[model samples]
Target chain A: MDNQTKIHIKNLNLHIGKQQILKDINVQIPKNKITVILGPSGCGKTTLLKSLNRLTDIYPDIKVEGSIEIDGQDILKVKKRDVTDIRKKMGLLSQRPYPLPMSIYKNITYGLKISGRRRKRFLNKRVEHYLKQASLWDEVKDRLKDPASALSIGQQQRLCLARGLAVDPEIILADEPTSALDPVSSQAIEEKFVELKERYTIVMVTHVLRQARRIADHVVFMYLGEVVEQGSAEEVFGNPKEERTKAYLRGAFN
Target chain B: MKRFFKINRKIRNTFHKRWMLLSLIVVIAMPIVLGVGLYLKSAMLLEQTSLIKLLFSKEWKPMQGLFGLWPFIVSSLWVTILALLIAGPICLLAAIYMTQYTKKYFLRMMHPVIDILAGIPSVVYGVWGVIFVVPLVSNHLAPFFNTQSSGYSILTGAIVLAVMIIPFILNILIEVFRNIPDQLTEASLSLGATHWETVKHVLVRKAFPGIVSAFGLGISRAFGETIAVLMVVGNVTQIPKGIFQPGYPLPALIANNYGEMLSIPLYDSALMLSALVLFVVVLLFNFASRMAIIKLERHT
Candidate 1:
């Protein structure tokens, strides 16, 4: 959304077991804009997105060496007690929508309630607000109390987005959020991401070149665990600097 | 060679189908036949004596022709409830820890240990209860609670039952927890929930129906447990006054009295009725649990 840098990933090397998944990556994610990490499958794109919020810490064999600073605080070096606070500043939409096994109302309120929001009026208003932001309020307004799984896949994805937004995160991390969706559903999510870019910093992972071209404001093209090129969307998509990036854009191979 | 191989494959398929059908018939027919036989025998006893008198009368004198089952019923309920109360929380917590928190090395070590625990015979558990649990409760747990017990009491049986059922219920719970997708936990964690919070809100909520069914199965096992319970409960055919007092559960009563049933007039029928009651109770619980699991599967 602006020229100001919000997240700075420096010399981030990630390895699972003996396999190196991310090799000395460095990138600056701008604030309040959609930064799409474009790469082939299994090329450490999801791994990179996961490390930004310290989600990779859950894996026992994972070793991460580097610092990821958000808003001048090195999240990688922060105390374990502060991880929750750090995570609270960002939301994530996974490849598949996993709505908490509860009513749609409770799914949105679960994060709020755990973060210590407990007023009925406030929860109601916030639920409506988030649902509207995801463009799901009208479709699900009458059945807010229904099980979230009862909705269609597209609706569930939007509901997942609403649930993520209800936490009031400053940034959104989506890992191939629309790959599981149909064309119409993918379009809906793309449009929502465009609308959400005005308020939240979004970093998306996508293997689809056209999707990257359509929704990316800033582009970071990664190949085989390395960032080949990164710049404004126009420059990277239209005039890629690296041969690997050009070959990938030309659909030589994924 | 190719025709010979095809003939071998066809033979294997036919053999497999035949075995599957045979097992299904054996499994279904045995329970139905036994249940009907037991029901008819109990029906004869019901006709000889009023159902109310058989159910409500506290006097269970076989010599004087009384067949009341109130005390045994009460004992069964009390012992099962105590066993479940003791085992349920410990088993659930152990299951959650094993699935959610245990390291891979520990988990590998634990799987065989749990399997061995599950495979140990009920008769072996009975012997162990007599030797170890009885003394522990009478000498330690009873004294700790400032009560006098002679080692064979409802509390002792309950403790033994609890130990026996933990691995049983825990096996089911671990499987249920494992079936939950990793994405659900990731979603919760990304929303700023701690590991424990994610477990409490997401994992537990997702697996609740399965957990409930596991408990139901555990309860049914406790209800029908005869050998271990008979060893520790001090079978006294009377309502227990306290956790330290002896009690007579239905299975124990039947197991103890079946040898002398032919000597008494309607005693065999009474014992069979008790068996019928146990069967029906366990059946009801299994059915409810099946329904709950199905509903959960359909929902998710």
Candidate 2:
């Protein structure tokens, strides 16, 4: 595997029920590095993330024309099996934690069970490893069998992170993981993101500029479904190349 | 000057106390009134029949001092359960389609379709069943069920009841499914789960209490339905050994026999006893519905 162009998104266009949403987007995601997609609400950052895994394909009446490639294999043109295989290499954590109506242990392991392959020893080790990685091992280890919903919102979000990590995906897509959390909780999640960049390429969509600035290794600024600019986090924040990025950072249009 | 503060303080103090007292009275009074009403009504129903003696005699003729209700009770329950068997899957499929797979236009059209089916009179349904559904079943469903009779049996009655009450179950179940958050569905689908899998694991799992309540309500609705059932079910007072067997439900018996009974205490007592059973069944149904709704509320 050439260590370049881990994920390539080219000429991406999206429409929801005949209204054009995202247009003419092109981006390259580098391997083993965080690429935070920063934008205002309804600016299509989340939509771009969802397209990588073809998650939007599930929505009926959704029109999409895009070339998203992973490791030089165009995922959209490839067979659904190949696409699902690619999806396994990419994990997603939504804005809010969605713990299944099951035990915490099972919630973390649901994806595996649904795929119809289970390994007890591996699952146990993976569960503990990911939980510890998400910094939720101590708070929930004693009550692994308890309902995941019993945990507080912050803990649930962390638990979801642990769940996503359990799949051992190299690329993690987090859609505003801390948006619904308290300040302290948000800080904790941000800290986790900073530490996670060593092992995983994390693409986080955050409306909060401070959060993006704090943890983003590379930043991709998007507005109205187009990437305005993308570069090293320091460069993007300190000297934004595009006017839209400047306007967004300065709290003008969302 | 202090009067204002004192009055405000009194209001604050009494808000919780008064609220609790009001709710408590309302809650406690309803059951009390219900219990007294049931007690009076049941006593009145039981007075006509020698309910105590009838239990031991095992004979089912009120004219001959034998007032057994075992067959009627059995038939009533048997019809309801049979009707549920016939209708449950149809309503469940309808619910799944309505909730998961349906588009906005289809959903918009659903109300009218359900409304038309629901608004059709029981007698009209009876007529329809006799004219349309019965022949269709006799030609179609009966072949599969394989009954000796060409038409008019427990199977026919249950199918009629099923057709009549399916919309009711669907309406209730749709509300239950609707109450479940769309976020749950989105969350599951985003995880690469299929439509049925999402429905089974997320949608149905989330809406279990509501579905159960629908079934209970459906059972209650089917239990008391008289006209349609009486029209189709061959009203013989047999054990209803099978769906194809001719049998009489409690309601049908009441509707048919209520007219013939005159100036006879036994006749009236039998009627009252059946009414008492119906009342108890209804009360239990309501209690079950309340419990399910409470459970659903907690689930949300």
What digit string (tens of lDDT, one per residue) describes model 1 on residues B32-114?
99999998988878998887888788999988888899999888988899999999999888888887775556767887898
Tens-place lDDT per residue, model 2, B181-219, is 665665555455665777888778778788888998899
The DockQ for candidate 1, computed on C-alphas, is 0.64
Off by over 4 Å in 2: A79-83, B1-58, B137-146, B189-192, B293-300
Q: Residue B264, candidate 2: how far off, in angstroms?
A: 1.8
Give the C-alpha miss distance for residue B32 in model 2, angstroms: 7.6
C-alpha lDDT (0 to 100) for residue B219 of candidate 1: 92
Off by over 4 Å in 1: A1-3, B1-22, B296-300
Model 2 lDDT, full chain set = 0.79
In model 2 chain A, the worst 10-residue window by lDDT is A80-89
| Candidate 1 residue-wise lDDT, A34-144, digit = tens | 999998898999999999999877766689999898987899998877788888889999998999999999999988998999999999999999999999999999998
